[model samples]
Target chain A: MTITITAFERSPDGGQGLARDTRVRWALEEVGQPYEVRLVSFTAMKEPAHLALHPFGQIPTFEEGDLALFETGAIVFHIAQRHAGLLPDDANARARAITWMFAALSTVEPPILELGSARFLESDKSWSAQRMPLVKDRVRDRLTQLSARLGDADWLDGPFSAGDLMMVSVLLRLKASGLLDEYPNLSAYVARGEARPAYKRAFEAQLAVNKPPAG
Target chain B: MTITITAFERSPDGGQGLARDTRVRWALEEVGQPYEVRLVSFTAMKEPAHLALHPFGQIPTFEEGDLALFETGAIVFHIAQRHAGLLPDDANARARAITWMFAALSTVEPPILELGSARFLESDKSWSAQRMPLVKDRVRDRLTQLSARLGDADWLDGPFSAGDLMMVSVLLRLKASGLLDEYPNLSAYVARGEARPAYKRAFEAQLAVNKPPAG
Candidate 1:
């Protein structure tokens, strides 16, 4: 079955690959799966059609035959579970890798997202400046623990799995914030993820769509 | 192998079942798995020993023999995959179920958590009052879409899978805010979840630990 996934016709990040479609693309690339992208404009995303697929009205919904799935974590996990490259063969190791995926999304990403909201959504608010540090510090606390646990390791657990993929993607959001730089190991970790051939391919794919046409 | 999980020594919610451990316990109960709980103090949660099991230093953590896992989504998923009751048998349906789990933790819960942080962590800030409406509106936006999707359905997808288990758990946090009541179907959905025998058992178990003793 041909897999069809959605992406932003013009990403808010302007081809930075921070938009969630990049995560789904990266997972497909890692697994060497050939898929098609159906780009949706921001307005179209909120329409009844898109909302039917993703109740959240977000990009990056996955469809293969009768199966329709949304949420990047689920999409990535679906790709990973069916493919060989993204998960370990050992049951325990696979479970741990999945744990990292949850940790990346649930525990780590929430504060980073809060920081983002402060910078973007609440930028004009009176409390934006005052609340920024508290938000960043919460992110820093999580990164500090993550950095300590990483402790000079390359990937989060064993060889690169969906966990590392998800974690690296989550940390990439902090790249502009410079908070990721505070932890050198994590910075290097992100760099290593970026260095992956699959990641490069995925980044280029999303970049091609969101990049502006040359003058 | 005995399945053991960790919980807060004294839950901040005072056993309201808002803690992530309650989600895990509910999953276990659905699967008819008897597990042991080890309560950890806040200090210990941040310490090295506990951090070894869970890099994020929050519970609940699942341990069985040599395998250990954290992040409630992953733990519940691990139980669902190994056990019979919490997931559907069909592959596509199962994927959709997992998608709901991801939706609960990633998309739905982030704003709820932000509302929590604003209320608890930033309560003293000058902008707390001003900023709260914005946070609550964000949550309402999600709930509005979610309520629309749910319509008259009893669950997000089908018959009481892990997705409903998780979505209900995430929505349970909104009960105190009364945001859930704004969406009658969502309120009823949570009521259905709480009414489950498994959920009831899980709630009481956590309540037993965190409930204050009678004089």
Candidate 2:
């Protein structure tokens, strides 16, 4: 069955590859799966058709034959489960890898997202400047623990798996914030993820769609 | 091998069952698995010993023989996969069920957690009063979409799978905020989850541990 997924018609990040479709794309690339992308405009995303695919009206819904999935973590995990490269063969190792995937989305990403809201959504508010530090500190606290755990490790656990894929994608959001730089090991860790051939392919794929017309 | 999980020595919710451990316990109960709980104080959670089991330094962690796992989503999922009951037998349905689990933790829970931060962590801030509406509205936006998707359905998807288990757990957090009541179907959905025999057992178990000493 041909796998089909959705991507933002024009990503808000303007091709930085922070959009979630990049994560799915990276997973597919890692697994050597070729898939098709359907672009959805911001307006159309809220329309009945797209909403049917993703109730939350988000981009990056996955469809393979009769199976449809929306959450990025799920999409990546599904791809990982179907393919060999993304998960370990050992039962315990695979469970630990999946744990890292949850940790990335559930524990680590929330604070970074709060920082995004403070900078973009609430920037014009009277208290934005005053509250920025608190939001950033919360992100730092999670990163501190993550950095300590990482401790110069190349990937989160044993050889790059979906866990590292998800965690690196989540941490990439903080690249512009410079908070990731505070933990040099994490910064290097993110760099190693970026250095992957699969990641580079995925990044360029999304960038090609979102990049501006040259003069 | 014996299954053991960790919980708070004293839950901040005072046994209302909002803690993530309750989610794990509920999954175990649904699958009819008996497990032991190890309560950890806040200080010990951050110490080296506990951090070895849970890198993020939060409860609960799951341990069985040599295998250990953390992150409630992963732990509950681990139980669901090992035992029958929490997931569907069909492959597509199981994938969709896992998607809901991710949606619960990644999409729905984050805004609710932000509401937690706004109410508890930032309540003393100068901007608390003025900024709360934004936080509340963000949560409402997600709930509105969720309510629309749920419609008259008893669960988010077919049957009462892990997806419902997780979505219900995520929505339970909003009960105190009064946001859940805005959508009757969602409110009913959560009530249905709470009404489950497994849920009741899990809730009572946590309550027993966290309940204050009687006079």
Candidate 3:
């Protein structure tokens, strides 16, 4: 069955590879899967058809034959489960890897997301400036723990599994903010993920779509 | 191997069952697995010993034999994968079920968590009153989309699986806020989940631990 996934017609990030479709694309690339992309405009995403694929009406819904799935974490996990390169052979290690994936989305990403809202959504509010430090500090709290656990390790666990993939993608959002620089190991960790061949391919693929027309 | 999980020594919710451990316990109950609970104080949770099991220093963490894991989504998922009851037999259904689990933790819960922070952490801020509506609206937006997709269905997908288990748990946080009541079907959906024998057992067990001591 041909695997099909959705991407934003024009990403809000303007091809910075922070949009979640890039995460799914990176997973497919890591697994050596040749999948098709169906780009959805902002308006089309909220339409009935897209909503059926994703109740949240967001981009990056995965479809393979009769199976339709949404949520980047699930899409990446599905790709990892179906292919070998993304998970470990050992049962215990695989479970641990899956744990980190949840940690990334549930524990780590939420504060970072708050930071995003502070910067973009609430920037014009009267309290935005006052609230910015609190938001960033919450993010730093998680990163502090994460950086301590990570210490000098390359990937989160052993090899670069789906956990690392998800974590790196989540951390990439903090790159432009310079918050990641505070934890040198985490900054290098994200760099290691970017250095992967599969990630490079995935980044280029999405960039091609979202890049502006040259003069 | 005996399955052991961790919980808060004294839950902040005072045994209302909003803690993530209840989600893990509920999953274990659904699958007919008896597990032991290890209560950890807030200080211990951030210490080295407990942090070894959970990098994020939050509960509940799962341990069985040599395998140990954290992140409630992953813990519930691990239980679901090992046991039969919480997941569907069909491959596609299982994938969709997993998708709901991710949706619960990633998409749905973040805004709810934001509401939590706004209520508890920033309640003293100058903008707390002004910001309350914005925070609630963000949560309402996600619930509106979820309610529309759910319509009259008892669950998000076909049968009650881990997806419903998780979505219900996430929505349970909104009960006090009255946001859930705005969507009757969603309110009813969470009610159905709470009404489950497994959920009831899980709730009662936690209540026993965190319930106030009798005079």
Candidate 2, residues B1-215: lDDT per residue as tens digits?
Answer: 88999999999999999998999999999999999999999999999999999988999999999999999999989999999998999999999999999999999999999999999998899999999999999999999999999999988789999889999999999999999889999999999999999999999999999998999
Candidate 2 structure quality by residue, lDDT tens digits, A62-83: 9998888999999999999999
Docking class of 2: high
The local distance difference test score of each candidate is 0.94, 0.95, 0.95
TM value for model 1: 0.99
For candidate 1 chain B, which ten residues in a row score worst on lDDT?
Answer: B151-160
Q: Which 10-residue window of candidate 2 chain A scores lowest in summed lDDT?
A: A149-158
Off-target runs (Cα >4 Å) in candidate 3 are: none
lDDT of 1: 0.94
Worst 10 residues of 1 chain A by lDDT: A125-134
In model 1, pairs of residues that clash are none
For model 1, the superposed segments whose C-alpha errors exceed 4 Å read none
Docking quality category of candidate 3 according to DockQ thresholds: high
Predicted structure 1: clash tally: 0
